[model samples]
Target: METKSIVLLFIMTAFLTACAGNSKKTVQMAAKPIMKKHHSVVSQYPMSLPPPVVESRMRTVEDVVNNFGPYATGQLKPYFRKAGVAYPPREVTFIALKQEKKLEVWARDGGEFRFIRDYDVKAASGVTGPKLWQGDKQVPEGVYRIVGLNPNSNYHLSMKLNYPNEFDWFHAQREGRFDPGSDIFIHGNSVSAGCLAMGDEAIEELFVLTAQVGEENVKVIIAPRDPRLLPLDPEGYGLPSWTPELYRMIAAEMEGFSDAVKVSNNRPFYPASSPLR
Candidate 1:
């Protein structure tokens, strides 16, 4: 009986020891940081584009403005002051030229669109039209969001946009092909194979603009031409038939964009703020 009891005790001790060892191993494994499936330095920010996906970086003002004259001067100042952005948010505008296959930004107050500057691009596999499908070889049309931004990236600085939004996904789902790549960005001038690219300087300006707008305020308008009608006479420009439709669509979509800002005759004004001021 004594021997039997002793054997039972030994067995219990061995079992407990094994359990303790297993617990330690489990804890060590749990302590390891789990990596995201596509985590990158440039994809760190929640809004804006990053270089990890786009392969772009920030550049100085001289590179963007001195080379390309701005569409409007000092227009960026209000946004800069309002957002307390460092450097001069005082003079910058983003230009997306479908015909030129280029996306550039310039610093200016206003005068002429001589800001004929050009930025580097990665792989652009689209034409001057709206992207309809995943493998359509066309960049998207309409306004989109820079929902993600990152400073550290596999390529360089970059900002990420919520490409293939709900509308895009819905369309894809209907076609029974849901395997769309989600990491599209406005990154450094690298080969996209299917993405848009902007030079380092232009991206920097974009970063500043996005930071000021709180990402939510950042609006990307890819149009056929500059809307200001600087080079062409507004009356004689003879816009395409699709132009009016597009404009109306945008205006309708922007309706009720701001609950506080009231629109009277297609103009927006903040009623909460005093008119006396």
Candidate 2:
């Protein structure tokens, strides 16, 4: 009976030992997954540098060019060829004329810029004037720059605009208007609330061109009207009090491009010629 009891006691101790070993092993197993996840995964909000610069992008700039470059180049190369300018000139300027709903492309050729081509704005939002506050639905007017290029845009692809720029912020701050809206872009698709919609084909061309020219090499100007034609008379326009000064600045800047020989809306647009484009 004593021998039988010893054997039973040994079995109980062995069973306890096995349970303890399993508990430790289960903890190790649970911890292993957490360690692997921490080391090998991206966070919910990825803080890494954007891809092509990094290895994170499932799609890269090369993919965009390959997918859309052929068609864009097909349409764009001719314009450059006709201008006697090399494709992807040194720099490019885009002028957005709100009243006429036209976006003109200009390229730097020897020392001055020349008119390359123009694209019809697919859609526009708001009336004439500058965007002031959030939800104002007014297209911003001023010299702007491309802030970024988005490939996964809901509207195909989009070029981000630096709206609420220093000029915008200065006015908004003076008027006590915080939240002077943002996320403005020149994107594809014929829809806009306060952005420039440049359709699929046009945006694709722009996207490819911008990627080639380098965002820093691109400039943008949004104007209320063709200041080169009709005088920018800010009188009685009932905008901001300082708007006349603004109109003068816009008109003066436009005079630089007054010489570009072009046809707008199938109508001849011949402004007084300037040495500049």
**TM-score for each prediction?**
0.43, 0.74
* Cα misplacement distance, residue 165 of candidate 2 (Å): 0.9
Report the lDDT of model 1 for residue 125.
55
lDDT against the true structure, per candidate, is 0.49, 0.82
Off by over 4 Å in 1: 1-95, 102-123, 132-137, 223-277
Candidate 2 backbone collisions, by pair:
none
Where is model 2 poorest over a 10-residue stretch in terms of lDDT? 268-277
Q: Which stretches of candidate 2 lie over 4 Å from their true place?
A: 1-58, 236-238, 263-277
1-277 in candidate 1: lDDT tens per residue? 9999999999999999999999999987776544442354436765476444664665543443443324223444454344344333334334454444545443332332123233544445554444555565555544567787666545455778777777556655776657654666776655553456665655655655555445664545443333332121122133333445554443443332331221222322222111110
Shift of residue 250 alpha carbon in model 2, Å: 1.8
In the order shown, the candidates' Cα RMSDs to the true structure are: 17.4, 7.6
The lowest-lDDT stretch of 10 consecutive residues in candidate 1 is 268-277
For candidate 2, lDDT tens digit of each residue in 1-277?
Answer: 9999999999999999999999999999999999888755555336584323445756666688889999998999998888778888888889997777889898875667777889989887876677887897888888889999988888889999999898788888898989999989999999988999999999999999999889999989988777766775566344777677677777776777744375343544434221111
